[model samples]
Target: MIISIIHLLSSCQDFLDEKPSTDLVVPDNLEDIQALLDNEYIMNRNSDMGEVASDDYFISKQEWESWNEITRNAHVWADIISPTGRFVSWNALYEQVFYANVALEQLDDIVPDSNEQVDWDRLRGSALFYRSSAFYNLLRIFTMPYHLVNPELGIPLKLSADVNKLVKRSSIEDSYAQVIGDLEAALDLLPSRATIATRPSKQAVYGLLARVYLSMGDYQKVLDYTSLALELGNELMDYANLEQGNTFGFKRLNEEMVYCSYFSSGSIGYSSDTFILSEIYESYAAGDLRKSLFFTQAYQDGHVKFRGTYMGNLYLFDGIATDELLLNRAEAAVRLGNEEQALEDLNYLLEHRFEAGKFEPIAGISGEVLLERILEERRKELVFRGLRWEDLRRFSGSQYEKTVTRDLDGEIYTLEPGSPKYAYPIPMDELQLNDMKQNPR
Candidate 1:
């Protein structure tokens, strides 16, 4: 098992404490710059706070009482205090932004010859994509949902490598604009496909844009971007082909995975104490391959837990994938009143997830009903992929809005739609250092 930074932090408090020191050797060459971008710990890891707060899994009352503070508070939507005495998610995401800025700044000085142009462009394109991805994740967790009325302040747009400089939080609109702008710039520079899934490609940028536009309710862009992405690759993994008896059935960098990344393994991640919610487990019909492939009743008490992570192990995969693109395209199509196309995309994915002879295409659905079906599948198909939190935020105040609840020690805690808690309180460490406005608690 490749224990990611989230796990490393559990034992190493100073693991990510390095400053962007000017005293260190500067990366002046293309190879040096590429090396910085290739550091998976800095670039591929994302915050898991959203996943911990989401409704896909729960901790038993006894386990909740025995777990760490971050785990207990995150599950109940309460204010979280990092066990390492630092907000891991906030610091880790910003660290990615910092690394990206370093590469981008260094790239300016090196003029690649014709022979090196391709590599140069790929490095710069990758940097832009990484920065944009980091910014998007930060906004989703620390800032208000894009659809909220006069959404709260956005996260700081850290564009430069200067550690001494402080950039205050921008308005929510401007923050999203920055994310979109960087992605658009990356599209022209990136190749149609990358040699490795860890690297971003044009298809990955399109998929991410579709996600961003969906959060902003720009159905047309979501439809357009997803269309372009799907045209490049729309292959879904056949769950029936996976070894159901294996502890983790899926493999890392699977064909459907356009960009491979992982999020933090929070205190509740993949533990015996953390069991899949009954509602979520039962939603998968008997013939649905996901029921067996994505979960297991291997616990001594027979509680079902997720073992089907795309990373092929306990590390949570939270990167771009074709399945998510298909769902995005389908949802956008239905929202645009093209139910036929929407169902075509939705059923295509479903066919591969069901038992060979048990699969049936969905038809005779239209309008709001069809839209609801797509959303429900989105919840089931992308469960534990760190997307449910964003979905919950975007669905707030809409017809699809839901009030998620948690039961710990016989007390129920609820997270209401459109609540300010949707945007977690900005870490006090950041506020104290930067003097930026704190998000409303």
Candidate 2:
């Protein structure tokens, strides 16, 4: 079941590059495989490549000018020509995929004793989860939007540790199928809950299922997974207990956290020169705690910066959380005409987010209006959490259709919904070496 590179490339190539054929590095025993999954280098979130492409952030012209060529191209929605110029996340993400495949491929030879079965299953499940996570995000970033998915090749589905397996892009449909298949396989083998946020438990699996189904617009599926996730890990951080004026109101591995992974960025995007949408930032009711808890006035005049990241620092946190599951459930419930359930879920999260006694439950809303309100709360609550780009993509054809435009030095850079730009060009180096066809924009 192992698939990896068989051919040798130039000496300059890194892990992302295909190289001379070599035997797959199978771990000798269960603990070695456990050690592989424990390698956070592959498990943790990579850089802010997708975050920079997202609508939530904007950098000044000076910042843009100083970026390397690839970065600047990506910043402006230009087809990237030099991958070295872009953030190195693609290489980083795939490295995780390859290592996960290594662990999974090695598992076939191990015969667990009666007492060893539990740990064996957990290790296999963890490997699958890690592999599935990497592929899911890769497809999200590099492939075309889901609705447009067809036979056209998406990112390569690297399922083996053996370097000899060819890495060719599968069709978008096949890509999703593999990802879902992997995740489904991982679910039963995982523990009910992981010991820590970094590990995959049944809770993280369900949370991931919600995210996957949400991306595919399967509201009922999203609701089902979210409900299952909350059944296990639904602790919400009450604003009443939060300490204000800190960089993060929520701490690492808090109850609300199902799994923790983070993206990284510099201070430029955090600055207020390009401000939060006044309307959105001002939408918080007087008693809402997020406005104060998540933001601070930037040194720039009339601008504000985001202080609330679940990572509790400047790095962008992108992991699954209970609050996100609630929002997903609310949105999906309303979409499925479960208004009562939607309201119940929304009220629960909103209650925790707003000042204790000042929080008033939303009432009398129904249908699309109720859905809009839920979606609005989602935008307000999850800003800078690495969901915006996908949100923009998913809403493109709906009434929520967005056309993102940035004014930089009097010039406008816009990313339109349904445009070819929506699928960022494959890295130039990948196109040069692989059989994969570049996205025609």
Candidate 3:
């Protein structure tokens, strides 16, 4: 039954029209349920729009002109229209939600004996984690920032595997509440650590909780979750020890990875013509090793390209990691008036990124200055990790508000803080099939 389901899911090219859940035989066993969730290609991949719309990198005018209309529109913060009428990110993420719902529904009826209890708990926990992660990713791209007093409509919350069951878009507040509730529920069900990085463990849950809360600007919860996650394992890879010139500077699922996931690859993000912004590349100080380790001069004109992703390939690493947790802890601590702890975590992480002996600690700072330092380091350290867009959205109207702009052929396109376009429009096909409201362009 599971094999048939896999075959059906893989063979379907259009997820929105011919849904994978249609006329499927449900798998009843625990192994089959785990297999459904373990399809990382389907479950672990997330939206790439965050990276494509981010300000970290830019493509040459010639290259941008030749790209698809959807990619070009996304890069310039314009209303996106898919020429092919397919939205891979939206379809792929909801497919993950469907698989998770299948696992959760199956677990409800299966009662486990003493020997099967652990596996039962793990499977249930994994399902909840995956669902929560997918919802958060969808919210980041399709919905407005959580800190907004009155956010726009969020993506539809499909809690059932029935493709015939239509779900409406939930309120932004309700959407976030669902994600937090699911993660909180899974806290006790997951083990302290998973056998592999791809599976959800207690540490991964904590890390993801911190990320979600950070997006919502709940600083206290961010601090608590980051603290809890670091307690499990807080190892940071030393940049000085890596082969800076190697094609793949970081190994896949390296020591810093708390959870393993990748963003869907897009030409805007992975193209050879995509070059890192000069401002960002030049910001790394003389002793900083990340400059060489994270980028390469891909053009004769001194234009640099990002290559330091932990995925060890063109795909962006969108998973939670210890370095991000430390930065989250630092920012949250300072926001909550724990400057001492904030500085400690920030400087500790930076020490590993610079030349071993020449590393100087960031000290004697507090208030907004300390906060900005942490945020700056975050931009430098987590480059091309499918996070900058989330940060930009959450920072809207704050002291760190940024106005992103793109220049093409002597014309400029700018996206201002708190703009409605921050919430991208729903895919045309989705809007046609469902009654959900589209975000105002």
lDDT of 2 by residue, 48-149 (tens): 555667776566788777776656776678766355633366776777787887777778888899998999999889888888888888877777678865
Query: What clash count goes with each model?
Result: 0, 6, 0
Write the candidate numbers in order of decreasing TM-score.
1, 3, 2
TM-score of each: 0.94, 0.91, 0.94
User: Lowest lDDT 10-mer window, candidate 3?
Assistant: 13-22
lDDT of 3: 0.86
Q: Who wins the lDDT comparison? A: 3
| CA lDDT, candidate 3, residue 98 | 87
| Candidate 2: Cα lDDT at 288 | 92
Q: Using alpha carbons, what is the TM-score of model 1?
A: 0.94
Once fitted onto the true fold, the runs of candidate 1 whose alpha carbons sit more than 4 angstroms away are 1-20, 80-85, 149-152, 298-302
Q: Please identify model 2 stretches exceeding 4 Å from their true place.
A: 1-26, 81-87, 264-275
